[model samples]
Target: MNLEEKLKQLPNDAGVYQYFDKDGHLLYIGKAKVLKNRVKSYFKFTPKLLPADKLSPRIYKMITEVESLEWIVVPNEHDALILENSLIKQLKPKYNILLRDDKTYPYIYINLNEDFPRLEITRKVLKEKNIKYFGPYSIGARDMLDSIYEIVPLVQKKSCIKGKEACLFHQINKCHAPCEGKITKEDYAKLVDEALGFIYNKNKLVTKLNSKMEEYSADFRFEEAMKLRDRIKSIKKSQIQTGMDLATNENLDLFAIKAINNKAVLVRMFFRDGKLASSNHNYIKQNKDDINIDINEAYSRAIVNYYDNELPLLPSEILIADEIEEKRDIEEFIKQKFSKSISILNPKRGKKKEIIQVAHNNCDELLRLQNTSSETSLYEDLKLLFNLEKTPNRFECFDNSHMMGQATVGAMVTWEEKFVKSDFRHYNLEAKDEYAQMRETLMRRVESFEKNPAPDMWVIDGGETLLKLARDIRDSCGVNLDIVAIAKEKLDFKAHRAKGSAKDIIFYERAGEILKLELLPSDKRLQFIQRLRDEAHRFAITFHKKQKRKEDTQISLLQIKGIGEAKVKKLLLYFGTFDNIKNANLKELKEILNEKDAMLLLNYFKNLEG
Candidate 1:
């Protein structure tokens, strides 16, 4: 239907409304209590009645591109709010305040369903029964995890039980080895609870680290003491600072935003059971295609998007830095998303106001640090793009190179903050088919956990099929590794009917499905993934060429039955060459070889050496 005809049919019920451009690209997603009244407001305005300045530049521009309108009728505004947020994340429309991030905050998870639950780190906060999750720490998540492992004698590796016998880790007391029945499930449950206690009471872990540092110093182990001191510093740096407590055991979240030079930063602080647990900060920027956003509007957009799209702890009270226009509307959203009452308040005075002020101060300092640097950290962009659990410190890229089925090889290049040529790995493959080659390559790579720990992320050169094989290898070997695949650039440029040209694309898991990056050639994401694919291809091709060169000159002596390198060496040493060995009789061959070897070799070369 056309714009006017569709607008005439708007229902009185609440719902999410979407505006689309002539070309069908989404312009905006919005929620309304009364669909007819809100949707009709746009047509009611005229250039003379509402001047350009009175209508926000953003709204004005959005209206210009809006050639058609569509909406869903819902029972209440709360449902509309959630639907709108989901649509925004799913479509990523041009006019929405896209909540781009530098990193995905990490949360400490302990699955209570398992008999012996161990603490682990993750980025996704899923809603599941018996899966208890702790802080979404902004920094030092690894340090915190390492600190917890020091005091907790729990399962350390994902694939801990390799065989019937206890491994060295159990012998060294690092693991209780529940796989081998060293500790009862009940006893391990107690240790898990102790570890959870440490998570709540982080001070205990800090104290233990301090004591270890002092012991090392007293023993004149300065190197060990220094390492301990660094760990302590990381814990302190990443921990949430104290603020004016509400003096109640209520769970709540306080948000404070600071806007400068048309840019904004929103700081979210968590308070559970009257304790300040942790806080996270993110910057808000206007898309180049969209109009600039005001600080007040940005605050509203963040509140709706944060809770509706990114599922966080449902707080009883949500305090804001300033009065927002959609305060009651947001409260309705929280009520529906989480079946509980929420107070979206702008406190004027007292302890609650002080909490808001603290959050504001945090943004001020964070903005300063952000501006001092020329750009955000490289790892930060990757974390947000791929939705990884942490700033990926260790990046390993895999590529398989071969001409047909001969001289097959697999290459892995490592990058830790920076590329490390010294750590590059090359593998010779035995499989003839592509899928088998990938499976065998990955199986051999992750089979040895003690030799090489799992990296934060693995980039493979192929599509979803190859990436799935990598995941299977990880699961069978019991490792927590993140695997993503980059599709090679299409030889035909017309494949880019939408993105302008053929470019290498990255495939990563988001909201359960594998998502292909909608990237352009000039985009930083395209450049970053292209570099990894190129490096892997270069290493694999180099290794394949070397293997082919060696194979070209050598005879297929290794293929002979019952004749290995030692037997071949003895024959050559006695007869001078392979030709000479082929001219020898069984009596002459038996002089240098054992009976079994001589008979097998003589039978194979009967016509030449009989």
Candidate 2:
């Protein structure tokens, strides 16, 4: 059915709607309480479908491109909100502001289940009981953990207790020697308590370290003193300084968003016990065609994406710089997901507002620094250099690595202001030759364009032939993406790999003709492309080595009588590693495979050992 005809059949219930262009590419996804009213608001009937006059520039552009409409009817607005967010993240519509930050901050945790628990750092929450976690520290988590061990006379290593004898740590007075019964359980508990005190109070820890450093200096132990001094510096530097404390010991999380032109920044400050513990910030940039910025939508997306995890570290109260339209919906989401009630507040005045102002100030300063930085100008120079229609704010670089057709792999790394490690991808290619491997990789990527739309440009790590190959692939897919390739300088008709002397050449199409350009080594544009190519090369090589190792493991397992590639794969998946498989008992092997195959594998291991 036509878009207009479909619009007439819209339901009145709450749901999410998606708009697609004539080319069958999604333009936007949105949720509304009344699907019919919200879907119709973007258009003016006038006997024909046309964009509404009062729409923002961004929405008007989206409406003009939208040729089809799709919707999912839900029971209520809450369901609609959740479904919309999920679809937006999965589909990544062209006109939506996606929160691409998938970083997990570090946390210092201790599992009290052990007799002598040792502090450790982890990025993910463990599914174990009697575990105490502290400070989702963005930095200095490792240094802080080390400082705790250095100061407190706790067990230094997990293996120390298993040895059943005094180790070097005990000799040096760093550990209380709980393994040999040198320290009682109560005495060890006191030491653990001292470590916990340091984790709770940063100032006390630094003061104690300072005192230790002075004592070491007075005893002519300069190296130990210097190490302690560095640790103290790191801990202090990692701390987020918010001079004004709320004075009420209330744990809260503050969010502030600020936008200038098409760029925005989201600053999050985490406070524990009414003091700032750590802060994180993410920069959000709109697509080149998108001019209108929606602060409310940005705020909603940031909050939703941050808390969209299995076990998020939620705060008692969330303070925001500005009131969002979906405040109640978010609050309800948190309560339902975590089964804990929390407040989402926009403080007009007082301590809450002041703390939020600190977040706002951070956002403003980050935006200002980013705006004035050379990175923004570099993209402009790139656009002019390549004769592109729009700035190449986001692009992907491709490289392939192999060893004589063995363990061949291709990698694509994304660069958007920085290397987006989360978006980077690796492909194990079956093709033996370089050209075929490149073709297979590019074809796979092009097939995924429906979900992840094409970037502004593609940087290929090859000469003219491979550059043309990338262009042909994009053209066959009907994707309007620019393509460029960088090739190292050739010496004696062979590509040179020397670092300093080689002058790489760049190839691109300008007007139906391939053009080669060799800029000076000092040019930033050339350096930028080189950096992208280098990152792609590094990623591909790393994947190739990993594939080689896995194949080596598979080769050893494939020697078993009943173990083929599929069975080996299944065994590896269940056991995790070859060492684990070697140590698995007959019962454990039977759980993954049949009794016959499990017995064969067990006998093979026994025979090998014999």
Q: What is each predicted model's overall lDDT from 0 to 1?
A: 0.73, 0.84
Q: What's model 1's overall lDDT?
A: 0.73
Q: Give the C-alpha lDDT of model 2.
A: 0.84
Q: How far is candidate 2 from the true structure (C-alpha RMSD, Å)?
A: 6.1
Q: Give the lDDT of residue 197 in candidate 1.
A: 74
Model 2 lDDT tens row, 1-113: 99999999999999999998887767789999999999999999897789999988888988999999999999998889888877776556777776656346777888899
- How would you encode candidate 1's per-residue C-alpha lDDT over 82-137 as one tens digit per residue? 67765665454556665533234577888787776777888776666888767667
Off by over 4 Å in 1: 1-11, 22-24, 43-53, 101-106, 109-133, 152-198, 201-204, 210-234, 243-246, 288-297, 309-313, 376-610
TM-score of each: 0.56, 0.78
